[model samples]
Target chain A: MKVGFFVGCNTAFNRPDLEKAVRYVFPALGIELDNLEGQSCCPTWGTMPSIDLVGWCALGARNYAIAEEKGVDMITVCSTCHGSLARTAYRMQTSPEVRNKVNELLKEVGREFRGTARIRHAVRYLYKEVGPDEITKLLKHRLDGLTVAIQPGCLSLWPKEVFIDKEEDTFHPKVLRELCEALGVSAPHYKQLLECCGMGGMRSTDMEKSFRLVERKMTSMKKEINPDLIVTGCSSCLIQFDTSQEFLQKKGRIYFEIPVLHYMQVLAICLGAEPKMVTGLSRTPVDNIIKRILQG
Target chain B: MKIFEDLQTTAEIALVKNNLAEEIKELGADKLLQCNQCAKCAATCPLVLAGFPFFNKRIIQAILIGARETLLNDISIWACQSCNRCTDLCPRNVNPYEVILATRRMAVREYALPALAVEGIRSLYDVGHAVYLSESGNPRRKLGLPEKPPTTLSFSNALREVQAIMRKTVLADLGIIPMEESANF
Candidate 1:
């Protein structure tokens, strides 16, 4: 399966290791990754989406057009890009008036909104295309009984109408859990499993309140599941959980630190990619988890 | 006697209809009127629990009744995380998150947006990415990848196209960024 990999701004800049992990895993599994060259930001929710509908859809269409021109669907590791791009595509597809208006706007820039390409988040791609069974067979090592607390991130499961890959039960999502199970890891349930990681535009709006949300989530995970690791499908959530633990600890709000991993990073490690190349830049140490995965 | 007198005074007041709900609907929140004051959105909202004065539930009611001034003067609308939990769970399919976004768009028109929001918009216009960092290339280089990751940052022509699209929209009218004629295509 060939696809255009939309490495969003955050994944490209903030966490290149996650980009490295994607580069490592997909080719190893026989999926070809194309750099959708000259692509811009997903424009994120805070920018064009907040401005006006046409502007939002126009920007989103430009990104979608890049992949559509290549005759392949686009896939992103960031849930924000998946949500923004997919939501915009939904708006353009469902509302002909919106489609015309956005197309008019796109016409100025020499692009069109054909809605030909599909937008898939990385985890959903692995779940749907790669299939957990195939992923399991491809793994050089299993999780070896590691327990993980999963944060699917909000975009992967919200406004179900727009997303092509909506979970069967959005309120109680199973894709992330099943993906982990396939890797031979235990992803136990927690009350705040579907809660926002308080990242995205929220952290920019109010850091204290944002941190409070993560603190509440971490507190719940520490109490209910107390898993060895926190795994998330979104890059922003990965940063939130990885970096916020330090502030929460310094504030004496939490007593323990649980290592965090993006699903691709974990999959890369399980696929026998070198741990240092894929995960050495993590804020919360993964040395122990690396030892555990390597020993098995 | 005093309570009766206060009630009489309250009844003498006029109810203002500012058409804020209609404005929000026109801005793409068509379900703004479907909300029946159900607080299910509030039950799960992080901002509501975080003590923001207006969240999905209250923001809907405020807009329906044309409480335009109250919304414009408040910071709660800008604080939405855009997680869409409210959108996902609302029984009326009101899409409270869209309402919040429309309210934010309304806020932007009046220059009532938060500073961070302005910065975010500015970054998108200036660098073609909302979260561009100058030092981002150092890390990409360390990862054995190109310093620029095939985005608008690497392709100035794509950035110009993005800028051209933004110029034709409300962004130019909002005056958030200068749209000069000299750069016309």
Candidate 2:
């Protein structure tokens, strides 16, 4: 299967290792990756989407047009990108008025919104296209009984009307859990599993309150599951969990540090990719997790 | 008894029936009035749990009552994570997230937005990406990847198109960023 890899800003800049992991794993799993050159930001929820509907849809159409022109569906590792782009496509396809307005605006940029390409998150792609059974067969190293706390992130399961891969039960999602299990890791249930990571625009708005949300989530995970690592499907959540643990510790709020990894990074490690190349550069130290994966 | 009377008088004075709901509908949240105040949104809302004054349910009620000044004065609207969990769980399909966005749009028009939100918008216009970091290339280079990923950062033509599209929207009218022709990428 071929797909255009929409490496949103965080993965491209903030965490290139996640991008590297995607590059390593998708090809290894027999999915061709196109860079979807000249794509812009998903514009994020706070940027264009907050401004106006037409502006949001127009920007999203421009990104979707890039992959539609390439005749391949777009896939992103970031939930915000997946949410923003997929919602735009949904509006364009479902609302003719929106499509016409967006297309009229796009005429200036010399593009059109055809809604031809499907937008998929990387985990959903792995779950739907590359089944867990196939993923297990491709793994060179199993998780070896590692337990993980899952952060599915809000966008992957929300506003289910727009997305192509809606969780059967969004309130209690199984895709992320099943994906982790496929790699032989135990992703146990936690009360705040579906809570926001307090990332995205909230962190920019009020760091303290945002950190409080993360603190609540991490406290729940520490109290309930106390997993070896925290795994997330979204890049924003990955960054939030990876970076916030240090702040939470320094503030004397939390006593323990839990390692965080994106699903792609874990999949890459399980596929035998170099840890430093795919999972390094995390703010929270991942050395112990790396040692566990390599030796255990 | 006197303090309670004063509070009641203030609430009565604060009530104004403006076209706030109508304005939100124009902004694409046509379901603002459909909210039943069920608090399902508040149940999952981080802003509400974080002790913010106005969250999904309250924001909808405030808008329903045309509490424009009340909303504009409070910074709670800006703190929304836009997680859309409320949107997912809303049984009436009220889409509380869109309601919040509609409120934010009203806030932006009133020039009531926070500086950080303005910065986020500015970053998107200036760099063609909302979260662009100049030093990010160093890490990409270290990862055996191109210094610039194949985005608008690498393609000036695409960035220009993005800028051109922005120029036609209400963004140009908002004048949040300089949308002049010379501001070309």
Candidate 3:
């Protein structure tokens, strides 16, 4: 099967290592990926979406049109991209007036949003297209004896009607957990597993308040799961968890640090991609986890 | 921690600012009045837990009471994660996240937005990515990826396409950022 890889801003810039990981794994698994050249931002919440609903759909439709013209579905590792683009398409399809207005704007560029394309979260895409049992067979390395804290991230499982690949239970999500299980790891439950990572707009606004959320989540993970690492499905949550612990530690907000990686990065290592190409840019030291995983 | 009981009894804060709720509806919160104040959205909102004074439920209450200036002056509205958790749990189908977002639209017109929000918009316009970083090249190179991913960054025509599309949006009319005719992109 084939899909367009929606390389969002954070994955492209802030965490290209994750970008590299996705690039490595998809081809290895024999799923062809189209670049969807000239694809723009999802025009995140703080941008067009905050400006106006029609404007939000217009910009999102621009990106959506790219995949539609390519005649393929899209997938993103960023929850914000999935949420924004999914909701944008949902709006375009639900309202004829909004669809006509967005298409009117798209006419300037000689493109129209036909609403045939869908943006699937990368993890969800894998779970649906390539089931976990097949994934387990493809692993070059296994994560045996490792315990993990799972972060599904908000956009992956919320406002369920808009998403094409939704959780069976929104609040009590289990897809990420089952995906982790395929790697031969134990992903136990934590209270703040589904809480927002204070990434995106919240982090961009009041960082101190944003870190308060990280503090709460890390605190819960420490008390409840106390896993060796944290694995998240969303790139925003990945960035927040991978980058927040240092500032949080210096302030004495927490006494310990847990290494973090996006699920794709770990899977890349399991698929035998080099660690430096996947986890090299990590802020929190993941060398130990790398050594452990690679040893198998 | 006051919890917005009866719209806060502060003498300095005014209520019923006259059709602020109506103005918000025009902006996109068409279901702004459908809310029955069940507070389920607030219970599920991250902003409320983050100690922000104005959040999903409270922002709706503030707007319903026509508290325009008060909502504009507060930065809490900008901090919403837009997770739609509040939107998911609301039984009345109010879509409280849209209310907070509509409040942001009103705030943007009045120039009540935070500096970073403006920066994000400017970046979105200039680079086609809301969170562009010039220094990301070296790190990307180290990872064996190109200095720029095959996004609008690497392709000039792509960047121009994004600029062309953004020009037709309400953002162009609001004049929030300098959408230059000849930007250095």
Name the regions of candidate 1 deviating beyond 4 angstroms. B1-16, B180-185
True contacts kept of 1: 0.76
- The weakest ten consecutive residues by lDDT in model 2 chain B span B7-16
DockQ, per-model, please? 0.65, 0.69, 0.72
Q: What is the alpha-carbon lDDT of model 3 when measured against the actual structure?
A: 0.88
Across A157-273, the per-residue lDDT of candidate 1 in tens digits comes to 887878887899888899999999998988889988878888877788788988988998999998998898888999999999998998899999999999999999999999989
Model 3 CAPRI rating: medium
TM-score comparison, 1 vs 3, better candidate:
3
Clashing pairs in 3: none
Q: Report how far off residue B26 is in candidate 1 (Å).
A: 1.5
Candidate 1 clashing pairs, residues 3+ apart or interchain: none
TM-score of chain A of each: 0.98, 0.98, 0.99
By lDDT, the best candidate is: 3
- lDDT comparing candidate 2 with the true structure: 0.87
